[model samples]
Structures are given as C-alpha cells and as structure tokens.
Target chain A: MTEQLRESLSALMDDEATELELHRVLGELESDAALRQTWVRYQLARSAMGGQPVSHARLDISRSVSAAIAAEAGAETSRSSLRERWVRPLASLAVAASVTAVVVLGGQQLYQAGSLEGQSAPVAASGVSAVGFVNSLGAVPMRASYGAQAVPQLEPAARTAYRELARQRMYQYMQEHAEHAALNSPQGLIPFARVPQIEE
Target chain B: MKCVARQLASSVVCGLLFWAGGVAAQGPVCSEADAEALQWLARTVKSRSEVAYQGVVTLQRGDDMQVVQVARSLADGYSSEHLTRLTGQGAQVVRPHHPLNCTHPGEQLLTLGDRVEAGDCGLARYYRFEVGPGERIAGRQSVKLEIQPRDMYRYGFLLELDQDTALMLRASTLGRGGKILERFQFADLSYDEPLEPRSGMDTVHPAAHPHPDDPTAGARLSVPWIVSWLPNGFTATDAADPEGPRRTYTDGLAVFSVFLEQLPRELRPGEGLARLGSSLSYTRGMHLADQPVLVTVIGEVPVNTARMVADSIRVAR
Candidate 1:
C-alpha cells in the first residue's frame, strides 16, 4: 500500500477522513488485500485502546482453519479424500481463531452491463472492432460504447460472420490461456470459467 | 475459565498480533500451518487436476454473467472435463485429458536462482502471499488465499481453495483501480463419488482447442519477433513450441500472448483495445511490406501495458 493511502486509512479511523479520502481508501482496500487487513488492524487497535469490548475475542482464524487445512492435507495425501463428503459446521466453531472476512458476495450481481460509461470517450467508430467487449452477456449486444473496434470494411453479412469468427477466436484464446495459466500457476481451474458461446 | 480470561485479555494482544501480521509479507498468521498460504497454494495447484467434482460455476465480468455446469475428473493423470453452459446459447465444450505441454512455473524458477527448490517459483518476489479468513462457498468450507501482485504490470487474484479438496472454488481478478474485473465462483459444488465424467455428453460439437505444445502442428519453428520491452519478470515460455504466429509469456503468475498474423489484403483496421472481463485483446494493424500484418496482444494485463507490448513487437529478419 502507498503511504498516501495509509494516511487516508488512518484519517478514516479518526473520523476525520474526507469523502474523497474515504473512497480512495475503500478503493485501495478493494484491490489490495493487504490494505483490507490493515484496515481491520487499525480498527482493532483503535477499539482495543478505547476499551470497546472486542466483538471478536480472537483476532485470527489461524488455529482452527489452519488445523482444518493441515488435517485435510493429510487426508488428501492419503488418497482417501472426496470418497466421503465431509461438511463440517464451521460457522458454529468459534473454537480457536476469529477472522473477519468481508466477502460482499451476498448473491448480488457483480457488474452491470453497459456500465462502461466512464471509460475513454467514444471516438469515431473504428473499422477494426472489439466484436463484443461490453457487458454483453446475451441481451446486451455490443453497443457503441468504447467499441472493441469492429472491422468496418466488411459487408453487413460478412461483418456478422467476422464477428462470430472473432468471438470464437477470442474465446479460444481466453480458454487456452486459462488452461496454460491453471497448469502454470497455483490458481487451478479458477482460470477457466467455461467457454463463452460461439454460435449466435 | 482461563480461556475465557485469555479471550478478554486478547484485546490488548490483538494490537501486537495485528502489527506482526499486517506489516509482514504474509497474512495475519493465525495458525502455524497457515503461516504462509504458499504451501497451501502449492497444494491447491496440485489438487486441481486430481479432484473430481461437478458444480455450477457463475462467472461475472463487468455485468456480463455466465453460468456453466462443470464436471472434472482425473483421467490419465490430467484433467478431462466437460463443461455445459447454463447461460447464453448453452454452448458446450468438452476437453478430454491430454498431455499438457506447458512448463510449470517451478520449472522456470531455476533460471532465477540455483538454490530455489523444485515446485517453488519464488512467487514471493512478485506477490505478497497471505491466507485470508475461512468462508463457505459452493456449500463447502473454503480457505481464502490472497495473491497480491507487488507490481502494476499484472492483476491480483483472490482465490478460495476448498478446505477438503484444495480445488479453487472462487477466483476474483482485481483491476481497473481496485474494482473487480471478473469474479468466478461456484454457485453449487459437489464431490460425491462416481461423478458423471464425460459419459453421455455430446462431445462431438467443438473438437479440442489446439494446444500450444501440440507436436502435430504443421508449423515447425517460430520466427523470433523481438519484444523490445516487457514487464520485469515475464519470460518467453512458449519459445520452445512449434513456430507459429504466436508467442506466450508468463511472470510465474500472469500470462499473455502475442499473435502477429500477416493478412493477404491491404485493407487494415486501426488499433483497438477490447476487454472481456479483466482479460484484454489489443489489436494493432501495420503494413509489413506491401501486406498488412495485424499484431494483437491478448491476456489479463493492463490495457496500457498490453498496448505497449503490442507496440514493442518487431519481426526479426
């Protein structure tokens, strides 16, 4: 985290952070996981000093979760994993550590299609296109917003055909890259989000 | 009784623990095993192709939501999975297990340092690895592992690895200034034995996508296209492949590809930048001799950086 962002976080704790500074800190917190922990730490330190009875008695989930992971690692290497589904009630177990994780994914749609308003201003429509780069799930076809340069030279019918080809090529590239990345990095199948539709 | 008092007194101790956890490289060390999520991450990478599970995965990128039913199992020591999209036109892709030709990042680590152990790429040089709080996702307990990039050349990832299986259940790529570029999470996941692995699916639709390491590629050797500038750590991992109009690079975690294809016609389009979630495709068209050659850079890198990479490519004589 940058020193400027850290200062804003400190200011946020003192209730003296300006509106812009709050946004900046929150913005940094979203990208930087380290910043999120620092935010939590700052909050914990302030509350600890104020004697504001700590809601989370324990600070980290280091013991229980780590034990769960270590024990699972043992079960995994033993080759008996996934033979029986083990669904333990982790929520009730305040047994060892307390971790404050803010995963705001409470069943809300993450991004809104056509939210590409603040990007670069729309210039003249370029011939080379992005095929479909916006919030174009199925309903939202490629709008004119920051267009992914559709090759304008092709005839109407040919343009559609080219768009389909481009979409397929792009999807293939994404999946192929994902496949290689999954094999190369620690992020497993998380990279492959199932291929996008090619036939439209 | 002592435990209760310790809990109360833990408020003061929390401050010291916070500093130890925050200022240091790793996450707040809550337990000994969770000291660094790196070991678990190594396990996570190993567990991916080995785990057998069927799940409904939802992918969200810039308001673009796609849902797919995925069933993956170990077949001949690699992952053979069938994915049927639940959303859009229901397009499906079946990938039969085959020899993966890509080199592991750990294999690429030897060039960096001779002392590094196998399977360790020394990712800490680029990312601050941390273990986040445990959370439930896809109806199973998961451990949140954060991979924060130390540089701006690549994006960061927040992954949730299954506690029991170690398969990544959730991955969110963060970019565009701390906003989520794409979030892929399993809506529901099941690890019950005897998973329906590619038995009766119509696998005839889309043949396997061509692998970069496929030996049967018609092209024998690739022309060395000099990339003048690259983000500090990225190395050409695809150089050993059958020479094609493409090149791929990875800096241990992030990966990108450069494709320079020469077109027959003189009609060429202007430079354009398109994005699918955090992944991007930046196409630049230029005339190589009398013909136009389009050099496109594709991957999960920043637009400006990708554009710069595209700008830096030059065909070697």
Candidate 2:
C-alpha cells in the first residue's frame, strides 16, 4: 500500500479521519486488495488494543498457513537430500500436527457417522481407510495398520509413523491406569514404572 | 495383607475381620501369623510413603523390559516421586507419593496398639501371608512377604520388603500355577533407612490421622458404574474417596481400577484389550445414562478376569 493510503487507514482506525481521508481509504480499499487486508489488520489491532473483539468473525489464516506450508515443503525437499535432517523439530511438528489433526477430525466424523443408531463406521470422508481409525480409537487394542490405511501402498516410514501414533495412544490409557495403581499398590513409586516416558 | 496394610492407615483390623469372615456381629478371629503379617504389611506400606529414596528400578514383563530412575521424597506433609524413564521414550514425571501430614490410611490403626492382635490381622481369609527370609536386593537385606491368594480368582504376590524400613525392594505378581507375571525390583538405590525431615514438616500436626469411623469422613458414596462382579475378595478401598471418573478396589494384595469416561464418538470395535506386564486393561464401549461411555477395567489380573470385570459394569440406576 502507498504511504498516503496507509495514513488514511490509520486515520480511519483512530476515527479522526476527515471526510477526504475516509473517502480515500474506502476508494483505495476497492481497488487495492493489499490495502483492504491492511485495513482488516488495522481494525483488528485497534479493536484488540481497545479490549474489544472486532467481531466473532473467523480471522483469515489461509494465506499465512499456505505460506508456512509452502516454506516447509521447500525445507522438506532440501532436508531429504541431506544425510541428517534431525534439526528442524518445529518443522516436523507442524507436519505431525497437521497429520494428527486430520486423523482426529476424520476419526470424529467417521465415528459420529457410525454412532448414529449404532451403525458401523464408514470410511473417512477424507478418503483414509476406516480400518485403523475405527479399530484403534475404540476402547480396546487391535492389530491395526494405521499407515496402510493412510497410504495403501505403504512405505516402511509410514508404518513407523502409525506405530508411533498407536504407541502414543496406548500410553495415554496406560498412564491413567498407572496413576491409580501408584496410589494403592504396596510399591508406591514402582507402579509408575509402567507409565511411558512420552507426553501427549 | 494390603487391605490390612491399607487399614493401618485408618480402619480397625478387628472391624475388617468382621467383614472378611462375616462370622458374627463380633469381630472374627484372625490367626496370629495373619496379625504379624499385617504388622509387617503396615510397616511396608508406611515405608514406601515416609521414607525418601532415590534409585533405578528394572521392570520385566514376559518378554519386555523397562528401566526407570525414581527419586522419592517426603516433604511438606506430602511425599512425592520423580520418575524418569531411563530406557525407551525418556518419559519423566513427578507424582505425589502420599501425604505424610495428611491422614495416612493406617496411621490411626497403629495407635490402636494392643488391639492389633498378632492373632487376627484380619486378611487371612483372602490371602495367606508368610513372612520369610528375603535375599538381598540392591545391597539391602529384605524380608520376603509372600501373599498367596486363597482362591483362583485373584493372583498372588511375592514381595521382598526392606527388612529395616519395610520398603519393598522387589515385587513379583504370581499368576496361575505360580507363574511369574511381572517383576519390578530396584537395580540400585541411594540408601538411608532413616528418613530425614525437610522444611514444610512444620505444619499443624494432627494428634492422630483420621480413623475409618471418623464421622466427618462421611459415608462411602456409591461409584457411578456398578460392578456386578469382582474377584472373590475385592472391596472398595477404605481410604478411596475419589469423586471422579475412576474408582479403585483392592482384594488387599491385588488392586484394580474401574474407569468410566464419556466417548465423544462411538467406536465400532466391540471389546478392546491391552496388556503390559501383569496389567491387563479391558475396554467396553456402551451407552450409559443416555450417554456414550467407555467402561474400562484395568488391573494386574488375568485378561479373562479383567474381561469379566469389564463385562460386569452397569450404569448405576
């Protein structure tokens, strides 16, 4: 955005804009997409500063998220070329978070669909197989291959990832049981040994 | 013995005998050996809470092994343990061991003195406790306390308790036919049998911990999920006052937890099972009180035993 139009946005946010400045901001907002985006940011920042929520409107996060994904994709491509790519934990976490989020949301949807009148869980609408999602998330442990469901042409790495997720889920139940056991068992802290060393 | 050991926290031994044997309105008689084992169990229970120690423990299941570093501390009326997994996953956690200042379950019974008859420690009907010479573990001499189950419903235990403090140095869960199910023993320990007091010890000291009959402790509330069946001798722990989604019970020597949780979505699987070491967890998803709920029975019991417990859960009407 140009300096003149940017100043108009600032003036408009402060509500100190003259009729000319108001018109300029409004006129520029129509032709300049960047200026409109800036105006939203300005209003958000102003509203937040004043301790007032602008509106309960969902903020636009797609652009930033897409930018982050694009940047990560590049990093992933380059990292795969190297012998060691252990450093970028945050980058890997983003990918894992995205994967788990999809799994959780998809599982919820599939489960909810199956839950109606106690029907069987259909395949996830996201096209992931229902095999692991239905079986693994149930109260019991089952022989499941979540990665195979993720990619029918399974890579060994995918199998490992699925195993990791299953292990994480299993630990959750184990930890809950361990906490109770620790309280009443004759061996106080010893029961806690059963608890896995992983944080959810 | 664990129930008696737990009873040492507060409930009367004679009172327990009344329930165990149900012989008469008067407390039933417990054998002299039963009473001595109860005393040993009481000491063993307290030692784990009041005594502070740091050590590395090795746990072995049928084919799996885990090593953990544990530091136990008694401070601020609260004893706590900091455990770090030395083997896989590097999981670390700190949990409250037990409250020293808070009324321990058996502290009141200890004050009962002569009432704790070497004759009737009151747990004999369910378990036969034999205190025998223990082999040394982690450079400390121990006394072996074998709790043999009176029936096939529950498993037995062989515990190597620290001779002086009664801290359990090694413990093994005995399966059917005396099979070794799981064993957890200290690989090495930073030893000091006598507990040292730290600051926070200066609290409003109660002359005695709350007794089982303490009116203010309130009557036992019914847990939400009704367990229609439990292993032969299992009863809700006297000190268990949990007002949450889970409740634990003990046959004294063996403990199991009943967890009731609402599922956000129903799972397609019918009965789910998980096993680690001696612990078996059985999860069954069923609607209760017009809500989707998962009833899980997790215990150091046989898979079939846990499955029966899980099957027996009903929504308390």
Candidate 3:
C-alpha cells in the first residue's frame, strides 16, 4: 500500500480513526491501484524482514470466512415463505426449547427420587418390616463408610444438577400427595412437618 | 448431472435415518397375552400386601437372633410383633389403614399427599432397578427382580416376586459390593386367609400412650458418640424424644436404635457389641462436657454397620 494508505489503515486498526475517516480510507484502498500495490509491498517487506515465507494461508482464511457468511445470508433470505421463512425456524426453536425443558424436567424427577431414597424408604423399614425385622448385627463388615463415600464419587456437577431438580419434583409430588390425602382422610388434616424450604 | 445424483443419494440416506429414529423411539406395544400375565402378577402382589398371612421370619446378622411374627391382610395393611431378647421389649407398629403414621414427622411420612395423586418417579432416590431373570418362589413361578443402589448412599434389594400377584415372596438387602446384608423370608406364608380377630390384633395397636410422656420412650434417645456419616438411603426414620432419652435411625431396610442414657461421669470409650441370632448391637460411651452419653445401635447388618450408624448419631440442637 502507499505510505499514506498504510498509515491510515494502521490508524483504523488502532481505533484512532473516526468512522468517516475509516470509511474513506477503506473506500479509497478498495479501488486505489497504487494503494493496493503499496499494501502488498508493505506485507512483503515485513515478512522478508522477519525471514518468513510469503503466506497465502491468511489470504485463504479471509476469503473462506467471507464466503461462508455470504452463503448463510443467502440461505436466510430464501427461507421466506410463510411456512419456510417464519414458521419452520420458529418451530425449530420451540422444539429445541421443549426438548431442553423435557430433559431438565425429567432430570428433576430423577434427582428428587434419588435424593429421597434416604427418606421415602422410612416406611419400608418401619412399616413394611412387619413381615420380618432383621436385627443381625455382625455378619457384615466395614462397608458402611465405603457406601457413604460413594456419594462424592458422582460427577459432582451432574449429581448436583440432577439432585436439585429431583428435590424440587419430590417436594411438588409430596405436596400434591399430602394435599390429596388430607382431602380424603376423615381426620380433617394430615399432620406432618412442612416440607422444609430449600436454602438458596 | 452430478448435483442431481448427489441429491438423490443424500435423500435416500436421510430417509433411512428418519426410519431408524422412529423405530427406536417406539416402545414395544403390550399384546393381550402379555397384559394378562401382568394383571395376574399385579393381583398376586396386591394379595401379599393386603391378604392376611402369618409367618415366623428368622433374621440372622452375621450370627445373631432377631425373629418376629408378621401378619397382614388387605383389610389391614400390616401388623408385626418384633421379637426381642427381653421377654416383652420388642416394639410393634400397626398400620390398619396406612402403613405409615402420618401423625408423626417421620422421614417423608409428612408427604402423605392424596393417595390419588401420582407421585413423581421417586425410585432413583434410593434404588437402582435392574431387570432380572424369572425364578420360582413359594412353589409358584416368580420374577427375579433387583433394586440396586445407583450410589453407595443406600443398600440394594433383591426381590423374588410371585408371578401371579407381583407380591414379593422373598427380599434381601445387599451391600455396596452386592453382598447380601440381610434377608426376609417366609418360614410359612400364605394368602387370602382371614386372620383371627384376637390373635394378633392388639399387637398392632399404636403405642397407646404418646411416646413422649413415657420415661421408657426416651430410654435410648441419646448417645455420646455421634454417627459421623449416614449413607444416602438412610435417615432418622424415627425419633422418640431426642430430649426424652432414646432415638432411632433406619434406612427403610435396617434399624439403628440409639440409647442415650446416663453413664458414669468418667466413662471411657470402648466398643460394646452384642449379637443375638440374626440381630447385631453396638454400645459406646461419650461425653459432652460433664454429661456422659451412651449410644447403642442394633440392627441386622454387621457390627461395623451398626457402629458406623451409631457413630453418625448426633444430638441435633
């Protein structure tokens, strides 16, 4: 590029030029034969000074990126019919959101169920054990702690994410069950501790 | 010419992919025969839960004696007489209507929502279910089912269900490595028979007196040594009166009874272990400043299991 043109482009890159100054510089460089020649010369001079080979790679990258963007823009324009233009993409977004929602919702149920694995089975031991209550104490070995430690082995993030979702669902289910039971039970009210609020 | 051929080839491939995805998503449709078998199984299972059956269940720890008389009928869900070494010490709970006592804040019992309302899939909280082979139990064909623990936080269950009623004829708890921890079986079990009104009826009565008012109610409520950890499926299933004296924790499958009674002011730490038939018990003494705490954990698991459970008992302020 010419010295003036190169200087202006450098200023533009540095954000030192006004928008108009940039537009004018870029506009002039776009069509200016001498400016183009000078710009090429400057790049060649810089690379040569560093003992680097002239790179066609950078040129290829800019061309490819611009080409991809142009293709995407064309596709976007063609998607214009009522069904093709607006509805399809809109429907696609809805479907994506719905799928995500389903996963999160299902995950919530699984997590809630898993967390309560500790609590719900209270009846299994207390109420259901009517058939048999084992009081055998020493046959097993030291695996209790081994079991406790296993909770941490879960992928921490995934476990937490699922656990939170599960807990919320369990609370909702429990609330619904309790409400329904109360309505049907003659006692007027089923007494149990309020489901404790989850701390944020 | 090239573009047309490429389009045709791509369309064929896309069509095949869509066909496969559709097939994968469709669940197997249950035929009439399959549905009949399932219905029979459900009836059999419900009978086990609702019909009156009497049996002597021999519970063995590594080598302890914990036996009980269990009788249930659909009219009354379940009633049991927990056998104890002490002539009349074993505790009994009856659920003529609901198996759980809704009046108490026991575990998730507080969530006794409308029985009609469907609860979310809460099984994953405590179990990992695995489809098992079909087997035979009580002279009837049955399905071998496993309720595995997805995490170590809970114990696993291996159950044999009578094919006709889906009633669990046999069930056992397993450890982290899939070792059988305890088993509940029918020395003699039957279904649909009417239970004598006076035979085991009083045994199912709710503790006549509020547990709080009775001095013995708090007998094992506190222990000096607190449990450092509790597995995922375990919780304080029942707490008589933490302030009274005795408390208990259970994992729906195992029970750990804690006795927080007075000990010598200067008692030292030691392992107090006991085995009776299939039951195991552990006792230890600890102190909070000047007060001494004696804690005992009794269950069908190993001594270490009781110890670990006892070690996790802490006095919640």
Candidate 4:
C-alpha cells in the first residue's frame, strides 16, 4: 500500500495522476512522514527541471497565518456585537460618521508625530502586541549606522530642521540619480519608474 | 500480469527522463554565445535612445506598487521623455530634450561607443548572462535573460526583452537567496508611435536648464574626498560635481553617488540610513577640513553595501 501511495504521489507531481490517486496521496500525506518527504523531493525535482532556483530549507507559515486570522475574527466579533445593536438601525449615518472620523483622525496623525504615537500607545497598552503587526507586514529590518564615533545632541527644533535639510538633500540626490539612470540605463524608461512620486 | 509489467516499465522510463532533464538544466554555462548576447544587449541600449515608444509600467518593491505611464521620443540624437504617475497624486514630469553634445561626459560615454567596450569588459568580469525560457508579456513574446552577479556587492537581474523589438518588457532585481527585491514590468506597450507634441498635459517643467554657459556646467572638480573601498568592477564614472563635488560610480549595471556637504552649525550630527523602494541612502557626519560635513552614499544597492560605502569615505592627501 505504501509503495502504491508513493507511486501515486510521484504521478501527482507530474500532474498525470488521476483524481483518485491524488486523493489517496493527500490522505496518506498527513500520517506518513516518508510520503511527505517523497512529495517534497518530487517538488524539488520538478523545480530543478524548470531551471529555477530552489531553497533547500522551507519555512511554512500557513499555521501561523491561520491562527492570526482566527484571532482577528475573535476580536472582530467581541468588539462589533455591542456596536451592531446600536448602529444597525442607523447604518448609513454610522458609516458616514465613521468615515469622517477616520479621515479626520488620519489627517491629524499624518501631520503630528506625537499624536501618532498616542494613537498606537492605546493598542500597545491593551496587550494586543504591536510586534505581530510588524511581523505580519514584513517590514524591512532597519540597519544601524556603521562607525559612528559620536552623536552630537541638539535642540528639538534644530534637530527637526536638520532632518528636513537631510531629507531635501537626499531627494535631490535621488532625483539626479534617476535622471542620469534614465539617460544611461539600457533598460529604457524602466528606470523612470524608480523616481519617487513627489507630491505637491 | 503483463499489463502491470508494461505500466511499471513506462513509469520508470518517464521518471528517468524527468531526472535527466533536471540534471541538464543546472546552472548557467558560459560560452561564446554569451558574447553575442552581450552585443545584442548593447544594441538594445543604443536603440533605446533612437526609438520612440509609450508604455504603462508597474513598479513593485516589497508590498508597495506604483503604476507609471511613460512616453519617449528621439529627435536629432536628442531624447525627450515624459513620465506620469498613473496611481497616487497623478504627478507628471517632463524632461526636455537636450542635445547629446550638451550632456555630461559620463552620460556621453553611455550614449557614445567608447564606454561600450569598458562596459562589456566589466560585464564579462562581474556577471554571467544565461538565456532562459521564452514567455509572453503584455501580448508580446519575450525572451528571458538572466544576469547572475559574480559577487554579493551587486544584485542579480532577470530581464525579459521583446523578441521582435528588443525592448525590455519586464525586469526584476534579485537579492540574496534569489529573493526578488523589486520588479518593473510593462502592463501594456506600444513601439514606434508617432511623437506627440507637448501640450496641456499638466506637466511640471524644470525651472532652468544646465546650459554650457552656466557656472556649474563643465565644472568638474578634483575633490579631496575619496572612497577608500568600492565593490568589485565598479569604476568612477563622472567627474566630481562643482556644486557638491559629488562622485558617481557604476559597475556597468548598478550606479551609486557619493555626496559630501557642509551641515548647519546649530544642527547636531547624526548618522542614519533610509530606504525608498530599492534605493537606499546612508548619511554619516564627519569633520572635513575643520568643518562639519555630512557624507551620504545613495544608490539602488543593498543596505549593507550602502553603509559600507558611506563608512569608507576618507580625505585624499
């Protein structure tokens, strides 16, 4: 039976297996470690044949993703039921109010960093753990500056001005790089897409 | 019994053939044909300036995506390009066409043939080009060209060029472990379209042109600042800028610029790194000639590479 199941799994890898064989292979895959190993080997082999790079170690995140979804669902139900009782009769009004609230709150936070922190602090204080948000978002890891001998302290206003100056200079450099790349790169106008869309 | 034996024999044969095929497609094999591919790529570069086209392209970095509409035209060896953001705030930028003679020396080398040899040689040393399977993109058949970097200093690229026009349809920057750092692909494209006259397109024109008579023009200075180290195959391309004395370097593919500028007295010195899309900027504060100057290295390079370059700056004797 194991030999038959392995043959079926290999056939499924080739996409030549019948539906019955696929079902049989999937059913055995859960309890059979040897069968799972065979399935992985078959996948690796297929990728190799396609001339694609394959990662040796695989990290499956499906279980964690499912857990996150379940947690979100639970949170949503517990929070929304109370609101639903009061808001169901005035759905349109409530939606309009919520939309206005979001826009006003979002705009205010965009201009004020202190308010942004205050907004996030409640979530952190509530024990929801903002670290999961960062992980789920797959944010780029920040790199620390290398070879920093000393950091000079400055007044808050001066620090903000300095940061603004640095940002402007960086933007200038980025624009110059993009313009030069546009003229030089063999890839044609593709380089132009790299230019940041500076909003007025 | 006979039928079972026949089925087993066929399955065994199929598996053997599949395994053999896998073994054959291992890695890029260098050959004389690669030279031809290089020449073809060079021709494509030249053709970009001479040909006119319009396309809608999507740029993807991490989870962010932006769509841009681009139009290009070439007249009398001068190329003009207009790019508009299809998404976001609908920002439009129009770059006026400047004659080839008015362009900087580095830009000239790229357009002219002198740098082609250097570029080709550098390419040969630093990258391996492999021809991959053909696919259809934006309703056009494209051939995949895989450019694997010889070292970690530079990222690899997988480009799909239109088989007929040699125009690039899709390009992806591959990072360590073959992860795609960024991707640019044409959603739709048209080649050799009639050049449209600049009209009421809500365009943002540059305030002033860098004319030959301008003081900044032809002001290539021999700056005292120098980078102690650079990635392999990278060479300084342009002469130092007169304004900031910025230095630009390229490895025939990736490019980076170094800027040394004076900071305000009241401002405190800080070192930091930032990334926007695939481009990164690393800034460090240092004392140059008794004045506080910030050394910034900016490029579409890996963050560590940018930091390394920023840290490697020193005053030349």
Please name the candidate that would achieve the greatest DockQ relative to the true structure. 1
TM-score of chain A of 4: 0.27
Query: Measured against the native two-chain assembly using Cα atoms, what DockQ does each of the candidate structures obtain, in the order listed?
Result: 0.07, 0.06, 0.01, 0.06
TM-scores for every candidate against the unseen true structure: 0.54, 0.55, 0.40, 0.56
Error of 1 at B146 (Å): 2.3
Report chain B TM per candidate: 0.73, 0.71, 0.57, 0.74
lDDT of 3 by residue, B230-253 (tens): 544344433234455444444433
Which is the winner by lDDT between candidate 1 and candidate 2? 2
Cα lDDT, all candidates: 0.52, 0.54, 0.38, 0.53
Model 1 misplaced stretches (Cα beyond 4 Å): A1-182, A185-194, A198-200, B1-35, B75-79, B99-121, B197-224, B240-243, B265-270, B287-291
Stretches of candidate 4 above 4 Å error? Answer: A1-169, A197-200, B1-30, B98-120, B195-203, B206-223, B266-270
After TM-score superposition, the amount by which residue B29's alpha carbon in candidate 4 deviates from its true location, in angstroms, is 12
In angstroms, the error of model 4 at B215 is 9.1
Candidate 4 C-alpha lDDT tens digits along B110-201? 33223333323325455777876568988899888888887556788888888877777888888867889888888988886634544544
Please give, for residues B1-317, the per-residue lDDT of candidate 2 as tens digits: 13334444444543564455454324534566666677777776666656778887899998999887777777666666666667776456655434563333223322222445533334566677787899999999999878887654567888898888787789999986788999999889875442222223212111112223222233343345577766554655443344246556665566677766665553222344566777766555455554555566667775555545654566565
- Better-scoring candidate (TM-score), 1 or 4: 4
Model with the higher TM-score, candidate 1 or 2: 2
Q: Output the number of the lDDT-best candidate.
A: 2
Give the per-residue lDDT of model 1 (tens digit) for B25-90.
343223332235656665665565467788888889987898878777666545666666666664
Q: Following a full C-alpha superposition, what root-mean-square deviation does model 2 have from the true structure? A: 24.1
